[model samples]
Target: MSGFIMLKHIKHLNLQYFIKNLPQLSHIMFMEPSYSLQIYHKYSYEYKNGNSNCDDRTHKNLQNYKFKCNSNQKNKEEFNYPSISEETLLALAEYFESFEEHCDSNYDVTYSDGVLTINLPQKQGIYVINKQAPNRQIWLSSPISGPKRYDLVNGIKWVYASDGVSMHELLNKEIPTFISSKKKDIDFTILPFGGKS
Candidate 1:
């Protein structure tokens, strides 16, 4: 099989660990997950034999479904997928900060279907791509890992530097309690989003 076909197969297997069955791909292209952030839900219903009130309750119950994942990491060295919690967001932000050539001001953020899509500054060795839903989150592998679906409702959101924001600046500017003791370094080329242009 071709590399594209193999890659799709890998993503298919990865998705099975979260979704009930393999996800239906409308078309087969090598587009990174970041470019696609649409989430579709097909609601289902069932008829119940009872009073109107009982029927209402039964219908509600049938509609109340959730997503859960079975742990299936392809690599033993990789860390478990982080939750989308505030801390996880922070961790991601920190990861971005560690890049040698920090390409700031080249990021974007959008929200759809309760999932937050964050585009980070691209750098060498960091291939990031992501598509997230409230229940299932998918990302293209970087120096980290390739694209895979994960559960994050209860998972902590580890914001890393990769999220493309200066944690020190945010903490100092947004949250006063995190004041740093050392003198802040200034970058003259960094543009007004207060990031390196």
Candidate 2:
């Protein structure tokens, strides 16, 4: 049978196994009838022929190789991250700028050029929060919680993908420990954190 006919009859398990064995066959079969296989084959051919000049080899699996070349590869939500990240970091910086001054003479909150540095005295430790524009992330280096890279997800929060924890959660928990000494309780609800903003 022809490759097209074989593609019609192949089961999912067999298809995966076949793709694993004949990696080039993925370029031949993993596509819709109307989709162009020429570009996919060109990449697979160049990849197999020792043309390591381009980044096609980095896709891991030769299957679905066509997506790497497609301009619309990223989903809609992913495209929104840059703007969300910018807003989130800016909100965080603004809040800390005002909050730090009243808390302690020894504590310093400095926000300059997309970096927010919180210096707490008496071994409370230094906090460095900065906007990583390229990665679309806000990096936090906290004394109590170590480090985490937060992505701006659907809820308008800077969330660490690993532990499902928001940057606000860590700050609300840890910030009070160092700053809530003046008979005043921290109101985390008022901060410009999560929700549809």
Candidate 3:
């Protein structure tokens, strides 16, 4: 209880220096219930149905809470089988191969079997696009967006459910930054637009 009050008081008084200057409180602050900059909603009892508005949480014994609004979950039938995902991933790999051939020597793109790998210029890192055939999803490990699973929507585009941004939209926004800044001629047509490029 005192730990909670002291944490609250410290924030209320904005006593960052005081806390930092005293190393003794450091052990207490990070112990078990760590006080952080973000507010944590720790429910004592099982979470039933409420307003259905929650972002992120964790529960060891209690029932976990879920976001009821804007879930953006689509029907499994909407995304086609292996053909759609395989074709899309392969097409992207070819586009990248063309880009790597035209772009700087540092950039590289590769595709084999059902996986596509792209190594960016400088130390920017690589992008991995692979087909999860069973799930009918295109999983991407991008240098800019980390890891994300994309599902084809309405047979028109590959969409990320968490933020509703399509695979084409994200690549369109980011891929140009690396190309346009260095080269004079960059064909954006190769990048997917309203549909598969």
By lDDT, the best candidate is 2
What ranges in model 1 sit over 4 Å off? 1-87, 99-123, 129-131, 143-145, 153-197
Worst 10 residues of 3 by lDDT: 61-70
Backbone clash total for model 2 is 0
TM-score of 1: 0.24
**Poorest lDDT segment (10 consecutive residues) of candidate 2:** 27-36
lDDT per residue (tens digit) for residues 1-197 in model 3: 13223434444432223323233333222211223222123222212334223223423212211111012223344345577777677777777676664466888888888889888876578888898876667888888879988766555677665555778778777777766354555443354432645
Judged by TM-score relative to the true structure, which candidate is superior, 1 or 2? 2
Candidate 3 residue spans exceeding 4 A from truth = 1-75, 180-197
**TM values, all candidates:** 0.24, 0.55, 0.54
lDDT tens digits by residue: candidate 1, 1-197: 22123223433232222123223221111122221112112112113333223345434433332121111221211334333333333443444343314344554444444333445444223334354433234443333333343322112221121222232233334211221223244331232222232
Q: How well does candidate 3 score on lDDT at residue 50?
A: 47
